[model samples]
Target: MDAHLRELRYFVAAAEESTVTAAAARLFVSQPALSKQLRALERRLGFDLFDRGPRGLALTSQGSALLPVAREVLALWDRGYAEARAAAHPHQLVVGMQTAVGRDLQRPAVERFRARFPSWTVSLRLVGWDDPTAGLADGTSDVAFVWLPTAADLATRVLISEPRWVALPTAHPLADRAEIPFELLLDEPFVALPSAAGPLRDFWLAVADRPRPPVIAAEATAADEVLELVTAGVGIALLAEGNTDLYQRPGLTCRPVPNLPPAQLAVACRPDEPRKEVHHFITCVQP
Candidate 1:
């Protein structure tokens, strides 16, 4: 077998990042060098690893299958390498959330994590992109608040499920209507998230039943960008009911939609590499 751990590491990084450039940046290597090594690995393995798209790279079925094994090997290696440091150094737990979760579930959870692990550093990170785990696959974050159907195969726990709502221009015709119907907003232009956002972008675009491709007037990676686009009449956006207050912007108004399932928020981590700190934080969440 020509299998090399270095090749596995590079392949996993490229797969998770879904782009050679991103993987290179994360791995601290030149893009061409990363590409060269990836091609060599593919040649050695005798299978294609990624499908290069205009937006970025996407994992092939074979690539997806290899990802978990690669992760397990890396985690085992980390455990062995970290054993000495873990004993002498203060343990630190990094947690990531898609948004600033300020509800009762999150507040007490933080407090409890701090009280329980006084010697450990607990850091809460607000993540903006669809990959809210912020490299959790590579062991960067111990836990993350992410949307369901994220990455297709990560282990997750649902935190909140709230109905989806639309943010429209204040002067929109449907502004007077208390609740806008999905049919009414079908033809309207929408602000879309980056393609890398995966299922999350599709959810926000209401892509399930549209007859024609949605008109993407702008691309937003954060809540503020969504509101800015909506206020400027560039496009409308869909969000969870709880986020209506958060994305509130001048000249933009949020209204309920008649029919659509609410977005589901989740806390996710690698299934195989369970950590004590991750459980402590998740257990603290009341609901």
Candidate 2:
């Protein structure tokens, strides 16, 4: 039986953390899901990986011996995958984004990038809000347009800073206001981002400014769903001002939240990224 990379990763995480709960958090997966994968891996290998006790998990003799080998395999695979992607897609750059980067940034930046690197092609990948790094953490994106308060390990530069705004159904009483005070909307049911989004979700919900947790009408993993829910009067959502213009629709209206701090849009890449193309793309997006 062959051990898949994902299984190895699960095993490695479990071994290092010595607790399934901690390992699950580190891997951004549910504890039960991680436990299931670890069990499946043990079944395939026909050996016990860990000695589960009340205190926590301890690696078995077989697991201890396999740990180093698994780490090495993962490291080698990551390096090889990067090298192969560069070789096969030498002229392409993948940019991951969660929402429409409207403020006239994306088109102009892409144009500038094309002019600078005439032989290169750009691929825009729309990632769900659940992955706050916008695919950067998974190595699927060469660069990303992400909201502020992202993972600390990634390098980021602010591209735009704008006031936070609220998206409400047109029929809502507050929709007619020129601008709504943050305090006025405190008790309203709000559309929230998935819990997987971590602090990014808190930022959108204005958790810091709230007296208590805002009522969650529903959760959405994408900007479109948030807007759709708002249109249906399911809940209101907080968004950046630029998005107000970009996502304007007949049944939806957006207004500024004067008391809230501004939101920032930034270009992020792995801090140690070696690719010159990634840096070049960052340059193109600079205001």
Candidate 3:
């Protein structure tokens, strides 16, 4: 009925306090002004919101029904306002990721970005690994830290290229071995990323040319979950060797897999609407 959130807030505060004096004190408005606002709101709704009682105030049926609805509207408006404010004010560079992007890479990149763009700030946004492009596909990030073979629409600059490694429970039979062949891991049940990850999921599974499907023990969206599943002996998983040391843990051990194709870590962004800041950040990380 074209009611503003400010009116809804006044109505909700009045309803909760059950008296104009208390509502005015809570809202920092005069008692007469609060009473006038409530009267206007009721007139807009074509209803009497409250009845004046000797002791305090009592809601009519319409006011009782509208109390929660008004509170909800006020809460939603507050959240939307905060989001718009952040969007309007920031000179931020949001980099999205799905895994443990090592500080080894991040520190260097950010240091260079600061030197190049002193007035800017950097933000790291962790997203679910289900989407292979991280948040770049949907424009949630100015750029993304993702594995190779992301959505074809994105342009990328490589960061690190490293061989795949397998993380296994320390107590597993094969954990004592120094290295393993890609063929050996075929029969082992493995933890996998979500199906929406597309070809990147296949790369981790070493399934580019394999005829048989992987026996997925569990699905995970982040590196920690994969390591946890392995530590619990749920199954083994593949990860880039560069991250093997970063994610090292007592219960899990990672070993090189020599036969699998190496993965490329890259900073990716949409080529069509590339931001100048994102381009500068990419140049900082490029070899």
Cα lDDT over the full model 2? 0.88
Could you give candidate 2's per-residue lDDT for residues 1-287 as a string of tens digits? Answer: 78899989889878877889767865779999999999888888999999999987999999999999998898677656755786789988899999999777888889989998999999999999878988776677888999988744689999888999999999999988999999999999999987667688899999999989899999898999999999999999999998888898889999999979899999998787888878988998857
Clashing pairs in 3: none
**RMSD after CA superposition, every candidate:** 5.0, 4.7, 15.0
- By TM-score, the candidates rank as 2, 1, 3
Clashes of 3: 0
Q: lDDT of each structure?
A: 0.76, 0.88, 0.80
Write candidate 3's Cα lDDT for 80-195 as tens digits.
55345447745778888878788477778889998888888888999876757776654567778889876446888888889889999999888888998777788899998765
Model 3, global lDDT: 0.80
Which candidate achieves the best lDDT against the true structure? 2
Write the number of the candidate with greater lDDT, choosing between 2 and 3: 2
**Candidate 1: global Cα-lDDT?**
0.76
Clashes of 1: 2
The model with the greatest TM-score is 2
Q: Give the CA lDDT, 0 to 100, for residue 260 in model 3.
A: 72
